[model samples]
Target: MADDLKFSAPPVMRSHPVNPTEPIDTLPELLNHLHQAAYVEMSTIPMYLYAAFSIETRGYSQWDPGVGASRLIRSIVVEEMLHLTLVRNLLVALGDGADVTFYDDKFMPKYPSTMLHRSPPLLLHLGKCTPDQVRDVFMEFERPKPDPLDPPPPDGWYATVGEFYRAIEDGLRRLDQTMGAKLWAGNQPDLQYVAAYWNRDGGGKPLLVHDLQSALDALKTIVEQGEGLEPGEPTVPVDPVHPKAGLDELPHYTKFQRIAEGIEGIGTLHDFRTDPHAGDYAADAGLTALNTLFNAAYSYVMHMLDVIFRTSWKDLKPGESNFRYHLERSFISAMQGILVTLAETMAAVPAGPTFEYYALPEQGKQAHLIELCDKAMTYFPQLGGDNSVRWLLAKLPDV
Candidate 1:
């Protein structure tokens, strides 16, 4: 039977435009910006994960710079999650439901892609970002600010992530003058993440926009964590999650630079790339089965998130909440497992090939979260083999 699916209009996720200098004036514009914010927050996580994971698993925590490089890349990926949550919190406050599975083409990263269509654009790829790639591409993407000559639209729109949110902050303040507290209509205080979401990840609260002050704080948190307090300067704080992380960790941009510097200091180049290939594990490579399974597993994650987001936690019965939470844990765990599967395939496959990450049409789009999971469950045997059996066992509810 043909799969039945009809998706809502994918959320607006555009971040740049010809008139980037145009300040946001209305609610639609603000929502559009928040949608863009969600995409921007999401786009970087996979890239960093790809790199952090591609390092020989054994080499992780082995060599000084290698270990440091891997740790830094991964830590930044976690913070990006905080940023995503903050964006979603803002969206819900603005009266929109957030969707993780909405993999629309807009803001969908293309390798050799510039984030905001800036001049001398930082060409990005979805593979291992090494020394050269880190400096030329990743650093450029997270640069403290954009160049003045390229265009001010970028300055207002394409510049540092901080500046982008600054624009959003400005919009919120402007809109507040007219809307007042009515502006936080979509706000859901209950959905806001505490330290628990991170598995005791020790970060501060997700951005909750109940008023101008909270909105600005949320934006400020995103900027300070990623871009730092000053332009083009380094600020290393202890990993807030760590017990002894006192002034030891740096922001994403700085972390990339540290890897680059570490590589050079060790008398070799970290060289992330000339163009992005999914390193060796690319699903686009000849590894069809592995690729399919990887995508399936990843798609399941989106489904799990959709469940949590669509329904309030408090509304769930104990059994349902427990089931949902454990399902989430399984899906999250499967993410790394899928990556490992691809890595194994990469090793076995011949040289000069790439594997692309893809979730099929049957996997469903943004709205079909539950239906998709049910369908995906049937394919567990082929998609996950023995592991699927374990997930199946854990998922059973006591009648």
Candidate 2:
């Protein structure tokens, strides 16, 4: 029997954009930014999960036009949840408890009016605007074209939110440089607080962002580690907190393994863990590899903020060309990429006991959801030809 599914748009809300540059000198200011970022992360979790649930509700049996697309989206949703967790953890670490009891949607930042401008020749590339409305949202946060003569900023220095951290980093660097070795001895509360975690582990290995060289070296190390290449193959036994071990221990792996095993032709997803035939590249080093990719990506993001704000803070006014939108958009897109890849990879692999029953009736519904994803993709070009969303969508295998 054929199933008929109809498409409907998700709910939209209007609110003011959270301006992070509003001169936050007090703890309240920092807390506000932390809260706002956390809220955004929290809101995204549901959006991704709902997209995934829509697919799960519809069974895998029939060839609904967009079933594959929905499945990919479901994967993206899960990763978004992980990002939310990451941000929440960061907030808690900063002494801001998980208190969203008073968080109103109206308080959430709105899209900038400047972003809505139709005057300029909008460049729609990765993270740029496109035709599809759904896709447009994904592409809206792309980086602007850099001036040729100035030479683009370094990898960590971004033109947007990247500036914020850059400012903080600059202050630390200045203090260290001017005060000599005694800078670390200062009693300033905020400095002390940031210094406390300067060498802390972010789940796997300890991350040290005290200097530019250290930051660069960390990125290189993460990339290398993801490829399963440790320098010198030290005689040390595997530490429980090692990136590889930590990733392997994630709960999602069990589910991924199950899905991989159930697929038709692919063997157990675990096979990728040891198979020499698996691609020899760093990015393809399986789950650990994916973790490394995310970490590197995040490092770049952090670095960019450090540089941008360090250079621009003195001249810029509050709420004028704020980078919050760009930051949020970058996070959303990167997270989406991670989740979709994880799920799709798992589904593509084959291994375990196959279920005898399939949800035939849900196939039509799943297809309908996939179609919505496709329509969303079309909206990307309309948003100024930004291909970022399209790039994200392309990562999924053709539906």
34-58 in candidate 1: lDDT tens per residue? 7777767776766666665455443
What TM-score does candidate 2 get on C-alpha atoms? 0.30
| Per-candidate clash tally | 17, 44
lDDT of 2 by residue, 1-399 (tens): 001100110111122122333433444444454444444434433333322322322344345433233343343334433333333333333344333321232332222212211112122211101123123322222212223454444432333222433343343345445555443232212211111111111123333233334333333332222222332332221222244432432122222222333331111112221111113233433433333232233233333222322222224467675343343344345444533333333323321111011111223422432333344334222211234433543332211
TM-score of each model, in listed order: 0.73, 0.30
Which window of ten consecutive residues has the lowest lDDT sum in model 1?
Answer: 1-10
